[model samples]
Target chain A: MKMTKLAALAAATMLAGMPAAWAEGVKVGMITTLSGGGAGLGIDARDGFMLAVKLAGRDDLDVVIEDDQRKPEIAVQLADKMIQSEKVDVLTGIIWSNLAMAVVPAAVAQGKFYLSVNAAPSALAGKGCNPNYFSVSYQNDNLHEAAGAYLAKAGFKKPFILAPNYPAGKDSLTGMKRFYTGELAGEVYTKLGQTDYAAEIAQIRASGADSVFFFLPGGMGISFMKQYADSGVNLPVVGPAFSFDQGILGAVGQAALGVKNTSQWSKDIDNAANKAFVDGFQAEYGRLPSLYAAQGFDTANLLISAMNKADVKDADAFRAALKEADFPSVRGKFSFASNNHPIQDIYVREVVMEGDVITNKIVDTAMTDHANAYVDACKM
Target chain B: MSALLLIEQILNGLQSGVMLFLMAAGLTLVFGVMGLINLAHGSLYMVGAFAAAGAAAATGSFVVALVAALAAAAAAGALIEMLVIRRLYERDHLDQVLATFALILILSEGTRWLFGSFPLYLDVPDWLSGSVTLPGGIQYPLYRLAIIVVGLAVAAGLFGLISRTRLGIRIRAGEADREMIAALGVDISKLYTMVFALGAALAGLAGALVGAIQSVQVGMGEPVLILAFVVIVIGGIGSIKGAFIGALLVGLTETLGGVLLPQLFGLFMDPSAATTVGASLASMAIYILMAVVLIWRPSGLFGVRA
Candidate 1:
């Protein structure tokens, strides 16, 4: 143990000597949903992260990517392999909340730094927070809370809401209700992975809601939007950007037109850092970068900033450097909250068709410097 | 709470039931005729949806898309029947299940390789888009009504084919005694292939129809497959009529249970906790129905005892 501590100190000293130079090999293990329903999000995140690393021309950053298949068990297995066998100093790139919940705790407990690209579960933001864990993405509730705040400000009274029945789903509603002051017309939890939303749509229609807020991510959102469109009860649907993200807007087609969603980043954010990142991403990937990509890009740049300031082998120094958050973020106003999740401006974006290509444009700022409700719960 | 809402929810149930029938019909026929438990039937459904999406994108015609789905799923089914599934016929149910499960993984990965991981675009055609007021003054999506019409028509046609056609008689005979039918100079293998392809085409049709509204992606079929299995189990493993009735029952129960249980619980419990509890119970309603049916009949609602 003494020898190991001495070796670690020596390694830290050696790594510390290289200031802003090559930080001597910081291995990043990315276990993300690469081949399943959530693959688009993970792919964009991975590509965005790699793009940042490429743009920075960092030789020390070695990324080992693996597919989690959106299964928690698979994510746990991959995290174990990445931590124990690969000995990666940093872990990142999990899209879904359940997978993040399964992997993050154990990984952080073992003293490896985890930089989250997306999926900020509220538990991690609250009492379960770890100093070693840093989420470049907003808290799980941030976008939902932003949506609720926007709706309340817009005076959408008697709003009906729905979400899938899962941990993230529950969190989404709770977050929305936190800022939403209006009386709920109806609240329903559809089964997770439920493709059929007819019952829910009918309920929404009958409930006499002035607006609808649903947190159905992935194909569930697509189905609900399409079905809601055809149901002839267009009560102004809104949610977080998961449903309206660039990755899936095309599949949703005209159904999502004019629908507002909340996010920390958009393609039309109009900042130097954001414009450069967007242009560079389009040039590199041949597609519009989703918010997931933005999160990933921010995460990589954050790591670069931290590496420039301190050696990764020195835990306290590296943690402080990460907390500094000196990186140029595509979101423009990104900074780590007290619990390491993002404390940033959330923007409301409206889905618009630009020459037959469905995408979103920034409409309004929903919330400014939105720190989560769970920040007080976080002791660390 | 309102009668109109109840009617609309019933309609929703019927629409979902029709889609399940399309899937369960094929599953039942394949299992009944071949004595095969095919866990990979859902993969065939996925293949159908992908084929449809691809064809729709290329041709800009829903008809072409549907035809592509039918042909692709049937062809895939025939190929598997000839190559892999034929060997598993003599094997136990466990072996068949394991083999078909493997087929599901292979087909899903192969689909991802072909189409990439992103969900493909498939929407309801222009003519079928929008809502119509039912006789009871309930507004319902026209596409769902179309699905019901199409499903019932298919069921009628299928029933006619089974009862009237010589092919249907042979299928029934083979199910009764395979070796005996083979000894009686029947082309058993060819018949099996044809039946498998037909069942696959039905699943494919269902996939294409549902894919327009839901998503066209890898692993999309697995969830539907589970529901379809539940449908067949409730309806009776080999009985088409049972599958139809069972599907409708499950769909109605699912839809109504999901909508009503929360409200029912709200009468005695807090609304939020009621919703939480009700949604959980609602998901299990169909499985509970299955269990009750199994206990009552010992072989499903319409299943024949050996």
Candidate 2:
């Protein structure tokens, strides 16, 4: 009985030692991909967000994170857990479109402010856009549309379209077609997570097209590029920012060289804001920054600015302040449109090799105030 | 739709078939020799890529990186066999699978811990960096051609070693009858370790070679591992020949389906809708092929009849 009493007293003493405000710290829950094939994106978002929190040194804010494991169902469940059990005031960090779609609606329904750090699904940008939700990233269609517009300006007469079979893939094709008024030799759709591209490459080779446009990210992109190069197909490859980002550039190597894509930011961008971001990220993480990292960094700034705007003495005020456009972003000057998506410029970039580095260099600006066509379709 | 396109697609199919063979070879050998279904086999592939990246970074030599990757993967497999796998060897398949599944979790997390949850890049060697022209005016990647050559060479070497070498004979004996082999003075545990190491080395080599062509990050191997399992299942778990054929079939069907299905749909439907339907169907094609094969040959093609 004496030992039990001593143990209880010890526990009480330890609890008392912690700052009283630690208990009242603004609780923000973050969910991102943490395992399986899509883990790289999740890891970056999670680590970047935590790093931002540390850099801010705001001990007044507490963060709880969950790994969604790339499943939409798991994401929904985790969002509920963060809201009800953890009692977090805000939610952030969704890397995939499906998971974002699944979790955002739930967060908005609960009137909890959702600050999306990554995914920019067009549905969320336009009509399906929510007042309670805000994006720190560009709309999903912006980059793809930028690629289409750039290719059209390049005067590529015959273009071939290819992407994985999914909603995002469809959006990419639609986004590209919106700007490129060329004779599409063909539009080919491949399986999501596919690793081979021989048949498609062969088809493209024989089709006599001038260029091939595809939207294969991750392992799928690597496999296809390798096969395309191996088959000796001479057509230049074109893609959206994601199809050949820093995440998989190493894997694609020389195959990705000379490929053109549209993007928001690249490590090679020469602006002062970009140089600081690139140098700081490399010094801290020992590698180049992906667009995901840029987006994550932007999210941190957005959230803090909102906090200052609403003078977040309480969680409710913090939520309301974030809903009001309150942040100065590194991606030029940007504000949330009526639909809660960022109205910003999309840049068309070209992939090149600089010594050992494989990176994209922005060559042209493609679009501004780029909103998805489906925005009006979404009545919300 | 022209004959030239058809011919080109066939070649594409063949190339894909070969790539799958590389993944399936190690999986089938390990399964055949030791009735263990190592779900973590893919994790080993990932380890190989990281090892290659680390070695190349240190030495500035791609060949050294390749060698180190294979050696490290083999060592890891042997170590794992000694520490965790040997006990499970006598257990049921479900238990073996569960243990290996646990190993995958540990390995993936351990990798993240060491690598700091970031991806590392591997460069293609300068020698094989360019594209080559084929007879049909087809342009092919030199590295890909090298991969095919290397894969075939390894296949030949594996066949020769299994058929002629003393260690291979012992392995064959162990596979045929573990009890008799043990009675004949073979160190069954040592043999198992060597066989497992050999299989791991092959997987490592595949991972290292392919890493240049794909992202080398955590959990990168799981998808490939699943496809390899499917290949071995179709090929007959214990039959290397079956694995080779099974992998090729899957690769060709999947590639061709992605290309042909869209064109077929375009003949009737709008190009946009056709693309959606085609891509969805293409992804399903290989699984459907696997199902059809299983229905026709429950024991798998070339599998020894139970």
Candidate 3:
């Protein structure tokens, strides 16, 4: 009689559009770089993500976090584990573009939802766009394109441009050129992970450019800014916000002050959602929220918003619910473009001294309702 | 690039060469006095930088930071040399490499645990913050010029210590024949510890100095360590003089290759394509140099024949 009852319940669960499983909640797999050089960004994002999940107070939301060690092969292995054995319904929290590229395509193809907190690489935003994939952050080139627009507006005619010799780096320069209406003084690709920039500094000085633009993220940015400050060329510098993010600004110190960088969000966005996020994040983590942290928070809240409307087991319903994006975003207004990447305002922020703290403040809006250039290429 | 710009780049190369020398000097010394290959030398360098950053944060004195770096790294070096490395002398190179590599992981993890994953701020001193206009109208950073001077001075001092002092004679003797030195009433074990501490101190000093310009963070030492190994290999592992020359060669090849390679390619290819091809090639230039050096003299520039 017990066996027949169990079979009857299973049949009922299958027939009623999975109403019983909604109470059990969804399992989320978060793979991010939690160690090595990029650990600061990942740690902040993780903290912000967990904070939002905690605030939801949903005991049913189960999140499993893993460290990728900022390596691509390790990320692939971890993704395989998350999909095959752990049986996660949703996958998120990848910080680097290369790792996201490696894991996202496969995860979404396997019928699991992949919500990106950071690293919205162009390939996934365009031709590789999948219905199961949703990017909560701006596409990788969004900030760079904004920076290019701002550089032209600020009247930097002969700007020297450079980035690491990699796919994203190439994309960064290309995006910048799309909106930059100037004759480039020089465009040089430096070795990726090359810390010493004295040679590059000398090249910049010799290039006779009116200003400088570069897209070196993380430690590369810190090293370059500090070295550039000492190099004495002192041209006006502009780039994307990755280099000047909150987690890194402290290490760069006063050297980063007065530099203009483009971003999709800043702490001082002047909205109820953003203010709450900034305060809540600081109260929870005891550290300032970075751009990535905001993304993590938004991603978690979006998942929470979707969960309210549909059972995760019902793929069509869940996806449609996610597409609604009913959650109040910290970026004032947020929406998904047809490609599933974000369409939002990109702001120009100047690094400033908030007493002893180094941080950014919004100075200008570079683009309003800026959908990425590759959105048209995305059939999905 | 103009003649003035070229001169500035050459200076940059020289400055980088001297910093690499500081790292290679310690590695070469440790290898020469003891046949143990230490992959953990980079850990000691990292210890120095973290120690300096922590010290600098507390006292706001660059001098205190430097002193703290030297002391902390030397202490750590002595402690490890006694506890782990003393037992490794009897082991083979592979065993020593494995053990030292384990030490690297331990030290790196320990550092991460203590400092967290954020980089510490260690800026150049106020006096050394700006550029100095050198002869021929080249504007160079004062800190880098100071590094060049200090490195050359340290090189001279090391030569004096090795050739002139009684302890130096004993070190050279120990390098030549450790068993003979042990038999001849010399405290061979004590000598080894002193040598190791000395090497560690130099590495610490380098860390503190370069930390001012670079991001002082965990794993900062690993990249520099690779270059140092390349230098020691090119210079002949056991010879300090050779290490210095080898570092300069590597530094110059790397710096000049980055600047000139693109220009060379630009003559035939489009400017953008030239830059792409040139950068890819330039990244390989130093390794190519190492290969050529190895082909001519397998042992190294100053390495004694095996």
Please give, for residues A71-123, the per-residue lDDT of candidate 1 as tens digits: 99999999999999999999999988888999999999999999999988888
Please provide TM-scores, in order, for all candidate models, with all chains considered together.
Answer: 0.96, 0.89, 0.95
lDDT per residue for candidate 2 within A69-172, as digits (tens), equals 88999999999999899988778899999999999987988878888888878777766777678888777887888889888988899998888877888888
* Chain B TM-scores across candidates: 0.99, 0.95, 0.98
Error of 1 at A63 (Å): 0.8
| Predicted complex 1: DockQ | 0.79
- lDDT of candidate 3 over B1-306, digit per residue (tens): 689989988998999899889889989988988987988898899999999999999999998999999999999889889999999999999999999999987898799999999888999989778999998888899999999999999999999999999988998887788999999999888888888888888888899898888888878888888889999999997788888999899989999999999999999999989999999999999999999999999999999847
What lDDT does candidate 1 reach at residue B95? 99
Ranking by lDDT: 1, 3, 2
lDDT of each residue in A1-380, candidate 3, tens digit only? 99999999999866564433466789999999888778888888888899898877766789999999989999999999999999999999999998998999989989999999998898898899999999998888999999999998988899999999888889999999999967999999998888889988998988889999999987888989999999888899999999999988988999999999999999999998899899999898788999989999999999998998988999999999898888989998999999988889999999999988999999999999999998889996
TM-score of chain A of 2: 0.88
Say which candidate scores most in DockQ: 1
Listed in order, the DockQ scores are 0.79, 0.38, 0.78
Model 2 ranges with Cα > 4 A deviation: A1-25, A34-36, A47-57, A225-234, A266-287, A311-320, A352-356, A378-380, B2-4
After TM-score superposition, the amount by which residue A361's alpha carbon in candidate 1 deviates from its true location, in angstroms, is: 0.4
The CAPRI class of candidate 1 is: medium
**Decoy 3 TM-score against native:** 0.95
